[model samples]
Target: MCTEELATWRDVSLVLLAAEALLTGLPVALILGASLRRLSRLMVGMRTVLFQARMYVWRTGEVTRRAMGMVAAPFIQLQSTVHGLCRALDILGWR
Candidate 1:
């Protein structure tokens, strides 16, 4: 009879421990869920910002390319004209 009482007390203690663990874990789980939700929202905002930044970089690069081409145009035209004059002089035996 003493052994049966001891066994019943052990079972009761085990049930109490499990209940305590569940109570402790519930709030932790809820906090983690909320943190994940906030993180998801932050990631979405970051994605939009990054996309805008990428577009701006692409546009800047395109503008730079066009500017460089415009800056080089006169030099290219002068060189081509010089080359054509030399070719014409060579054809006429002007050396």
Candidate 2:
């Protein structure tokens, strides 16, 4: 055999190992990339849930505005009633 022939079993094994790497490496790399993408999406969702949970723990619904809206409505209604009564009393000349 020529010296260029892979003369040793070690040389043949090395060539086979390289061929195996070339054949399978592309598929392994693709699988790893797909798994990384899925892991990234899962991490983002987990972060959002963690942030919302943190905000809730900080506020306990105290973040909601206290309602003072109803406080003035009843007084305005009382004033209107008094104005109507005064007008009726004047029309009758009863006061």
Candidate 3:
């Protein structure tokens, strides 16, 4: 082929290659943008779940402490009753 024809062919090839690159890159860019958006949403959801779990644990601890206090009340009352009986027996000369 003549040099002028070869140059024309090279120019055409370059233009076609650029067009193909743009066409291929557009979808890839869109897919990556969508993926990033989904990842952001997932991160936000994870943070919410973690915060809720932490609050649940904290509330559970508070409930457990209150339950223990309730369970100890009878024992405390029994001790007080026993102490009063001991004093009464001592006063009655039943040591």
**Which one is best on lDDT?**
1
Could you say which candidate leads in TM-score? 1
Tens-digit lDDT string for candidate 1 (7-95)? 99999999999999999999999999999999999999899899999999999999999998899888999999999999999999999
Tens digits of per-residue lDDT for model 2, 1-86: 66657568669899999999988998999999999999999999899899999999768655443233366667878999999999
By lDDT, is 1 or 3 better? 1
List candidate 3 stretches off by more than 4 Å: 53-95
lDDT for each residue of candidate 3 in 1-95, tens digit (9 for 90 to 100):
69999999999999999999999999999999999999999999899899999999999999998998899878989999999999999999898
The predicted structure with the larger TM-score, 1 or 3, is: 1
> By descending TM-score, how would the candidates be arranged?
1, 3, 2
In candidate 1 the C-alpha lDDT for residue 61 amounts to 100
Predictions in order: lDDT:
0.97, 0.84, 0.96
**Candidate 2 lDDT score relative to the true structure:** 0.84
Which 10 consecutive positions of candidate 2 have the poorest summed lDDT? 61-70
Residue-pair clashes per candidate: 0, 0, 0
Model 1 per-residue lDDT at 2: 100
Model 2 TM: 0.40
